[model samples]
Target: MNAAKPTASLFQRPAWVALFAFTAAFAWGWAYPLIKLGFAEFGIGRDMTGSKMLFAGIRFCLSGLIILTIARLTGRSFSLKEDGRKSVVGSCLFLLLFALLNTTLHYAAFYIGLSYSLGSRASILNSLSVFALVLLACAFYKSDKLIFRKVLGCVTGFLGIMALNLGGEESGAFTLMGDGLIIANALCGAFAGLMTRGVNKRVDVFVGTGYSLSVGGALLVIPGLMMGGTLHNVTPWGIVILALLIGISTIGFTLYNKLLTCNPMGKVAIWNSLIPVVGAVTSCMCLGETFYSKYALAAVLAATGIYIINKGKK
Candidate 1:
């Protein structure tokens, strides 16, 4: 009888998973500028909360449907057999909070902030989510250890953020509300990350994602309808954006879940620092935005921070 070949171990699976996660982060980073463009096309701004909600709702709904179809065609099971009730309940709560805070605030605030701030500054500021996650991890879950190396990494990353900010034109009307919204958006993302850890303990990742997206998308539609975001103004470009959102969400979230399963939360969190660099580069290249020394400096700092953080782990 022929000897059976050994299957890849869990640790071995992470190399490919981490690579995909990084790619997904890069794609998502580009999505910032794309979303900004879409909002501009629609003449929507931060003050247009209703319109923003509507736009986000439509994008998520379209993406969710596409993901559902793809999941089915791929022969991936959709049934929430394990913790079906808990998953549904948890997903519903997550959806409500996420749509209300994370989705709405993130898009609206980001667009508004980008108008006031430079692309590099906005991108680097966005990396503060890592800081938020770190604090949350330390306080709530104790899932990660807070050592000198991690602290150094975070400090370096913050310096990158500072570099990016220093290169940008300052917004004169920096309101408490706007800053609050951005901070809240980061907190929501961190909370969502934490919540996913809990949910994944019981259900499969795809099923959980499907549930969250469906419920969250549906909730977003209600506010969207109230805001007059009809099917009338959606252009071909809008449709393309919607399609990309779904594709990325499906692939990115799935891969992220796999990575989380295989690696420490802190390690995965550090990868987030790469997002700003990717976003800034993509925006400059695709949208003809200008690049500056500050952006390069920020990238270097963030890269160094990520390396330091991850190196200490191994």
Candidate 2:
């Protein structure tokens, strides 16, 4: 008889999970500078709201189509079945709303706030999404544990964010409105992440992403049209931005979903604390921004926190 294939030991699984999470976070980090670049090229603030909306809409629609095609080609079943269709539909709706809030408010806040704050500061503040999710998970879903390791992880991550913030140069006006908008963006992202956990149980992650991006992108069209952004003036750079967005949505979410199959959501989220550090580093490299000592400190803290959180957790 042929020898049985060796199954992966428990020790092997966490390593693989951590690897996947790190890769996902890296790709997501790269996307931040790309977004800023796109905004600069497209004259984000100068562009009519309608134009921005239309630009976002087209990108997401294309992203959805691409994912759908990939799903079909891979022979992954796309049907929700009658019983789960309603849940899928509801999840899609929430996703659309989440997308709208994230794309509109988050970008708006970041751009506006960037003008007032230093890049380091903005990057740190952006990392607040992790904390927001932790709170939301505790209050609404009862999904996260407030254990010592988790608390330490949160604190360590927050410190890393602060280090990044303190390290960069200030640019724009620091208005209360800008601060509030950024906070709102963090809240929306937290809610979206939490919602994805619930939704993924019912539908494929790609399907959920496709539906959400498509519907959300479509919804932006009406507002875009109202805001005077027609289809005529979109530049090549705009197209590039849209493409990146789609890529992030498909690759980032798909990997995240895959990781979830083998790990707890909270554990996975802890890795996300690395995003700000990655973002700051990438931004410095690509945009010629200064790299500060605080960034190094933040990275160390984030790394230590991840170790504490994931160590020995099966």
Candidate 3:
């Protein structure tokens, strides 16, 4: 008989779960504006696709190394024998595939898509990943079945996302490189959530996350460099922004992945609706961008959706 899968005792606590989830959301929300700032500070233009990829690759790769180093110090084994199903090479290959889908392809689409899309539209479309996770979890996880409350909560949260775009100057214009890719990035996030849960069951959550980010990030750097990507005219502020982004990935992904292992997917995912709301409000505050009255409404809607999802829990 197989032994039970181990879980992080601390993450199972309600307070810690709430804290980490909110922190992750806030960090991700802040990343929108920060990324824009990084580009400006480093003199990377909208058309510098390779540079964008390289920037993201460096951030994630460093974050992964940080996680791995911490995990090693904490005595987590880097071995794949725990699964007993795949050979060492096979396990590496498995993780490589996960890294590809979860990090490389996902963020590649995201950085490129952001170049072609408006920030407001990107915020709304990217938050759609929350809904995707809720639905996908139902399909894959036996515990996360579909229900009226789940549907209602999702609709409400999604309305919050849509609310942010109301009265905005964004046109209905769409492109495969812009809108389509952002939507695809959202879907990648949804799928990655599911994959995180599975990986956690077999390996240490931090280890899996570390591998995914580092390996996937390296893949981006190779092609990015080949395409002549460069972080030119980088200033001190740019370096600081890059470091903060690395910290964001390290903290946000580590805690979020840990939360996934211990909580219901729908309940955990519902909070993601707040990301765009936070992104919109933060963009205004940090980027000297326009603030819309609809932002307040969006926050309330997102909060309400999270309450409903958690309140109706069995």
**Per-model TM-score versus the true fold:** 0.81, 0.76, 0.89
Tens-place lDDT per residue, model 2, 1-314, is 99999987442377777787787777777766776666566666533556556656666667666777887788876666454576766755655565565444444454445544444445555667776666566666655566787677767766765555452244333345544555566666677777765545556666766666666666666667777766553589767766886788667666765564345666777677777777778778877876667667767776676667666776
Report residue 204 deviation for candidate 1 (angstroms). 1.6
Runs in model 1 with CA error above 4 Å? 1-12, 73-117, 167-180, 230-233
Q: What is the overall TM-score of model 1 with all chains considered together?
A: 0.81
Report, for every candidate in turn, its global Cα lDDT versus the true structure: 0.64, 0.63, 0.80
Error of 3 at 51 (Å): 0.6
Best by lDDT: 3
Report model 2's TM-score to 2 decimal places. 0.76
Q: Point to the candidate with the largest TM-score.
A: 3
Superposing every Cα of model 3 onto the true structure, what RMSD results?
Answer: 3.6
| Error of model 3, residue 283, in angstroms | 0.9
Quality of model 1 by C-alpha lDDT? 0.64
List, residue by residue over 33-113, the lDDT tens digit for candidate 1: 776666666666656666766766766666656666667788876655455455677755654554444344444554445
When summed lDDT is taken over every stretch of 10 residues in candidate 2, the lowest stretch is 165-174
Candidate 3 — worst ten consecutive residues by lDDT sum? Answer: 165-174
What is the C-alpha lDDT profile of model 3 across 1-314, one tens digit per residue?
99988766787777777788888988888888888888888888888988999998999999999999999999997766467255666666767777988899999998888777656556666877887788889888888778877778778877876675567354435578887898899988889988876676557778999999998899889888999999998788999999999999999999888898888877677667668777777777787766556656766786776677667465
